[model samples]
Target: MKVFIPLLLGSFIFIGGLKEGFVFLFSLLFLLSLVAMIIGLIRPSLLKFSNRISAMKVLFPVFLASFLIVLITTDPVEEPRTDQETVQEDAVEQKETEETENAEEQSEEQKNKNEDENAAESKNKDNREEIHNEEKENANEESDSSSVNKQEEKQQNNTENKNDSKTLDEKESDPSNDESTNESTDSESDKRPSNETKGTTATVTRIVDGDTIGINLNGTIESVRLLLVDTPETVHPSLPVQAFGPEASSFAKKTLSGKKVQVEYDGPKRDKYGRLLAYLWVDGKNFNEMLLREGLARLAYVYDPPYTHMSSFTKAQSEAVNAKRGIWSIEGYVQSDGFNAVESETETKQSNNSSTASTETKTSGSSAYNGPYNPQGKDRNCGDFDRQKNAQAFFEAAGGPEQDPHRLDRDGDGAVCESLS
Candidate 1:
């Protein structure tokens, strides 16, 4: 009875477990069945009637049990579209993750690329600096070489000058010179003349500044600075040195810096200093004239004939002086206090005093002019007249009139400045 009760309870529990899809109960049942078969084989008395079923009778029940087992154990076949959709969702999620990882990788790659570019730029900058340093070194070397060449040339010229001087001294000392027999007097004269002629044109070279220049005119090397006209100083180390200095220097440089200038002999070809005397010319423009015109230089008219343009130059200087343009802009500039000042002020007075004086003058002329000068009135026309005078010139120019509320027709009664009405 106890065994039967246990068997009944176990079977009920097994069936209940199968309903819940529990595999443990089914496995327990299978194990129990195997044990029962083994016991039945070992001892036939152990087999129960319930367990020993007829084959034909059990076939349908076995088939139903098989069908139920299959129904419970086998997974349901899902529709192809639904399965595909789930797979695609998972695939899409994986793809998104992959994309995110790829994006991160790409960002890292771009960052590395930027770092590489920056490093390359830095390397290139360093290389450029090195190249610049090398170029500067080369330039310094070239400059040194040029300086050495110049020194060598200067030494050579000095040696030649010394030799020439010695030859001249020897010739002067001995009157019965060897050249008298060897060379004809005409030939000597011709040679000397040719040498002098060559010296004149050959010595003149190039102008360096407004004042000075190298020349190869007259078979000898010479330099002449200009005379009379004082140009402003350039090449100063300190700034704010002179107001018009650069302008003056530039003007001078532009006028005469480079040219085969004709030196109109001022006094001697040079002063006691042995420089050339000349008014410089580039093209047809005279340096002196330019300096005067630009107000950079004054016509230093101490001498005549040479100072022929003195009057014209002085006139230009006066205009610059009057306008107070360049040098004349300095404080306390002088001007002639003549009829010019009086007439100019009369035309344009800076004060209301002139306006008052004009009215008083008009009052003295005629008392019947009871118009603009009626200062004792407090009417709207009077206020309007004042406003019109303040705003428009036409009203003030003609003197105000009475009976106009707008007071716009202060001039010529019916006219309103340039307004047609």
Candidate 2:
């Protein structure tokens, strides 16, 4: 009976165990029943519940029959999608595919357009260069012919003077002609000034900033950054406006604006920004060297080999510095270094997670922070912060110290200046 009960339970489990959740639960119950029945059979003296055992034997067949009936009636195949749903899914997939193809086509068309424009520009530039070369050749030929004509004319005049020598001798060296020639020379001198010849004439269109100007050289306008000079940065993109930056620019305007100047290139014709780098000569003076000499500018040391006017300009700048001129007059202007300050801030941010929790290096000695440093003092009481990000930002800005004026992360914890849990 025990062997037969286990075989029956196994058959019932095989039939209905694959149906769903409840089928597995019933299978587990049948397995336990089979185990109990075997134990009861092995030791009839152990199991005292005779009535319950007989009831289980009577219920097993009925339960197995019921399980078989339910398994036969249940459907196993998955439900099919409706026609409308299937159509909608197909439309979405097709739309996505078309969009991808359209994007690819647009990108290819843009690339082709860019290539065509570049080729057209190159061809135009080549044509312009060829035209310029041809014009230069024609001009050389004309000048050569004109010089030959002038030489012939001078020779003819000499021959005519020789032929007229006899008439002049008869006239007794004509005092009237001599007086007329002297009068003509005096009149010509009166019309022409002694300071007539100026250098390469360029009309100054605009002053870009201190030490920089825009001028029409020949016919084309070009930007000129003065060589051997760097004024206080007024129009600099990355620097704060300096106290004397305006004064320097005003000085440049008063000195050189609207004047015709001469450009003299040193080593390189153009700087990296394509500005013509030159010593601007205005009114018989080198304006580039003048800027430093007058203390309106500083002699920057960023020049290359064969530095055009390095020593002279450096001496000028040293004199300017000692005299406390222009930008140097401002107490902290010369001392203020935004670069080191920014670098210190960056380092503080990166080293925030260190075990010390404060900045790896103090801000005073390394950078331009200049904030009072007292690491052992009371909490500097930078106000409460809700978010850790804002606190960390302020902490970095406040010189990144655990015990500085703006206290952040007082407990020397990695989290600085915030109570955000």
Candidate 3:
């Protein structure tokens, strides 16, 4: 009965171990119990030790309890998965991985595309700005060209008119008859004021500045300040030579010096300075309008309203402002009262510094006067220097022929103080 009981318990444990994948100790215990059962059944003398002990009497019952315990504690083996279910799970995981990879690639491509679009937009913006600047420059050039053509045409017409007037005068002065006609004309002319005569032909004796001139009107020399125009002060009593001042003076000298101009008086004939206020027409072109169109002067001294040619003068100034010519080129330079000379002086100083630096290396060994020759300094005269060479050096240094700030080169010739020893 002991052997049978132990054998039955061992079989149960071995089956439980195999089914549940138990530890090695359980397998070993099952093998040992089977051997002991077989030995006791084959040899009766081997069962003598178990019979001598009272504990051995309950060994069958213990074996029965052990078999029941093993049966209760053991877990059932799970069924294996089918091939189709395993393949389906693998396919699902692969699909999810592919979707994630595709999403990442798409995000990277979108980022790159946005960056390229932004770069292209920036490039297009720069190209547009460049084109706009080019258009502005072309428009300014065209305006300047048009003004030059008009001036040329007016000059040609003036020449023809002058020739016709000369022919008429020659025919009238034939010294044959018309004494009574001449006496009637003289009596009619005596009724008008000589100094305030309108449309008087005068020879420009000297160009005082941009907007002022000395004219010989009927054998009388008079200082005429152009009406309705004010240029930058090159020779103001209180103001230092402002920016574009020298250029304005140079333009006047080049165009109106020694030329015949028709002086037309307005309501006010004289200014506070006792200078004649008139509109000078040079070669049939309004000289005041020319100065304003070139940006060399501003429309000013308009104390009297409803003046003739006011609309045309405003249009000329508008063109200059649009083109940013001369005084208009400097921001905030032209003010309501006058020009702001501070910025002009600063620019002049910077320009002079650069010019000096460039010429320093070239004039290092030259015999030219190395002394200070400030063009913007106090007015100098031919008597300021002792010798002709010294005067010439100073004049050239002070921009002599182009800019005679000191009036050293009186005749517009390159030489200065020519009579000096």
Question: Clashing residue pairs in candidate 2, if any?
Answer: none
Predicted candidate 1 versus true structure: per-residue lDDT over 156-236, tens digit per residue: 445432321112124336655433432433332222112222123322354333445445554555556564554433221
Full-model lDDT for every candidate = 0.46, 0.57, 0.67
lDDT of 3 by residue, 1-421 (tens): 9899667666765885654434333444455555555555555357554442433343444445545555665567788989998899899999999999999999999999999999999999999999999999999999998786566455544543332111112323654323543444444322322334447899988776898787888987787889888788765423556777768888998999889988988755665445688888777678887898899998776665666666566656766877989988888787666777556566678545544543442244234556554444677776677789887877666554544556665544478778998
Q: Candidate 2 residues 1-421, lDDT tens each? A: 9999777667766875745534655555566556666666565345564655664565556567556755665568788999998999999999999999999999999999999999999999999999999999999999998786566455544543332111212222566534454454443322211232323678787665677777888887677878767676544422333444556677788888889887777665665345677777777676876777667775543434455455454445555656776545544334211111222333334323331332333334234332453332333344455566655654554445322223243433345745564
Q: lDDT of candidate 3?
A: 0.67
Which candidate wins on lDDT? 3
TM-scores of the models, in the given order? 0.27, 0.33, 0.38
Candidate 1 residues lying further than 4 Å off, grouped into runs, are: 1-209, 235-241, 301-306, 332-421
Cα deviation of 324 in candidate 2 (Å)? 1.4
Worst 10 residues of 3 by lDDT: 160-169
Q: What's the TM for model 2?
A: 0.33
* Residue 185 CA displacement from its true place in model 1, Å: 52
The list of candidate 2 runs beyond 4 A from truth reads 1-199, 335-421
